[model samples]
Target chain A: MDLLERFAKGDDAAFEALFRQFEREVYGWILRIVRDPAAAEDLTVETFWRIYKARARFDPQAPFGAWARRIATNLAIDHLRCRRSEQELPEQLGAPGAPNPALQREAREQIQRAFRRLPAKLQAAATLAFIEEKSYDEISDALGVSIGAVRLRMFRAVRILRKEFNRMGLKP
Target chain B: MTKLENHDDVRAILKKGFPRIRAADEEPRRDLWPAMLRKLDAHALRQRVPWYDWALLGALAGTLAFFPTSILLFMYHL
Candidate 1:
């Protein structure tokens, strides 16, 4: 049997080969969503463990990369949800073109706090759609939803953020 | 302003606030295969049946063997 067939049959060597092939892509995808190297590393491992456990259900003819990405995306969304409950927001390095360092830091912090407070689905969609400038189709695939659903999440995220930012007197 | 302009404003604000997007390291610092192996190992260990559970299962079998009527009781409980 070929690699995909072998992997579906629960062959360890085949699983390892597939893991090596997709490791960087999965890790990079998760890192982009989570934006934390340490958390991304842990989530990547979790994603693969899950993928292996569910191997019996995988169709050999299907694309492995997309399957791996969907698993990684769900794990990243869960991580974000857990972090949201804890209200943890990482500090961003000061960006150029901001005249006041202290004021800029405060604004960024406020934005981060509000952004993190969004529902995990909306947060993920917005992060991929807006900040990363990823295509809607790509975001939809990773999110395991239709393009319409992704657009809805994006709209909700943007509306919530705009309201929060306006209330805080941080206009665009 | 128009709807398009409103969206652009929000997008610009988001870009300004989330500057780390530009600086994020895309590549992982280390291979994660070892970690995946460890997790699989841990799960395999967890999947092993504990002695207590096996003992309980044995006791149930013995009870059912001795009193076939108990099979009805078990089915009822289930």
Candidate 2:
């Protein structure tokens, strides 16, 4: 609580502690949305920068985690929207600096092939929950869906990921 | 014999059948402190639109648009 107060008051140490606590989670959450690590990192930094600029205005009664997630969510969505009109995949996320060819080929063949086979909703939901580590509530906010809907999507996604993992002899 | 209580085949199958899910990789940053600090700052800065605000706006708009019309064509008096 004291930490929250300090953070509310612009104490760097308090802010540092808070960042350490949620950095990966936030980054993962955004990455789940964008599906690109490099992009996610950039967005993560941007999200935190926005947080720093907006901290004083936060309501103490509100859930801080959800609040921060909202920022990252909007930013990630804005990013996706910006990219929507672009036909080709961007250069950075292009096929250039990926894994070694053989491994990449296998991984891509296995992952992308299976991914494409699933419904769009399932793919999005699974990646967000499993890969991103977002809580149900956070996913609901990010996706702008109800809690029940998020859980249902997550349940189906888990099944798909488990099935895929099993096919690859990977432990779920 | 209770189904697979002491069945080696079942145990082996169970262990072998489970799927492996690899975790996503973390970012290159050494510490999350900076990011978290930023998250708090960002959270505080939300331009939140509360439900009541919307409700009030809707009500206000309704009031402006509404006109009182209390004329009964025929009122039956007993």
Candidate 3:
């Protein structure tokens, strides 16, 4: 049987192997979405816990990475939604320059600010498309939306981000 | 400009700006294995059924007792 099947049968070793394989990727993906290292860790653990609990329903034929990513993405999106009331966008972007660590961090923060301004679904779509570099089909599966919807969300997200960046006097 | 023209402008800007955002591949700041293990252990413990579920069960039992013939009908449908 496959790893998922073994896990479904309560094989602890199989579960451990799966966790070790996907832990970093899952955690990174969550961190990108939530922009909180602490919350990302908690959500990563919760994703794995969910996977373990729902192992019996897992289709062995499906790609494990995609399935795990979908779970993590959904959890991250839900977390973002819950914390929506408290989120704030930074007012300015640093001037453009050669790639330095400080410049990179500033750009990242600005991107995050622009990102936070989007609706949760739009954020998910844009993140999957731009940050995760996922294809439309992959993003559709991850976000549980049609490809058309994903495209629309991406479009809207970009539009909003551009407008916000313009207001901040940042040439996007 | 038309909406389509605005959309094109936004797309152009996004193409330029997106790459400026850093790609993160960092490990979690702290180890999470112990916490996860604790969560797993907690999950292994028996879960308490909610009061509403218990009430629903009692109602079903009472209904079955009052109309035992319904059991035969349910079995037939199954």
* Leading candidate by TM-score: 1
Looking only at chain B, model 2 earns a TM-score of 0.26
Each candidate's number of clashing pairs is: 0, 14, 0
lDDT of model 2 at position A168: 56
Q: lDDT per model, in order?
A: 0.83, 0.59, 0.74
Task: State the lDDT of candidate 1 residue by residue for A81-170, as single tens digits.
Answer: 999854544344344236998978777776778788999999898888778878888999999999888878877888887876676666
Model 3 clashing-pair count: 0
TM-score of every candidate: 0.80, 0.46, 0.69
lDDT, candidate 2, equals 0.59
The sequence of per-residue lDDT tens digits that candidate 3 reaches over residues A59-83 is 8778888899899989999998876
Clashing pairs in 3: none
Candidate 3 stretches greater than 4 Å from native: A85-111, B1-24, B47-78
lDDT of 2 by residue, A82-141 (tens): 553322221122131245776445444444444434455555554555544446666687
Could you report the Cα RMSD, in angstroms, for every candidate shown? 8.0, 14.6, 10.3
Q: What is candidate 2's TM-score against the reference?
A: 0.46
lDDT of 1 by residue, B20-44 (tens): 4434376678878888888878877
Q: How far is candidate 2 from the true structure (C-alpha RMSD, Å)?
A: 14.6
| Residue pairs of candidate 1 with colliding backbone atoms | none
Indicate the residue-level lDDT of A11 in model 2.
83
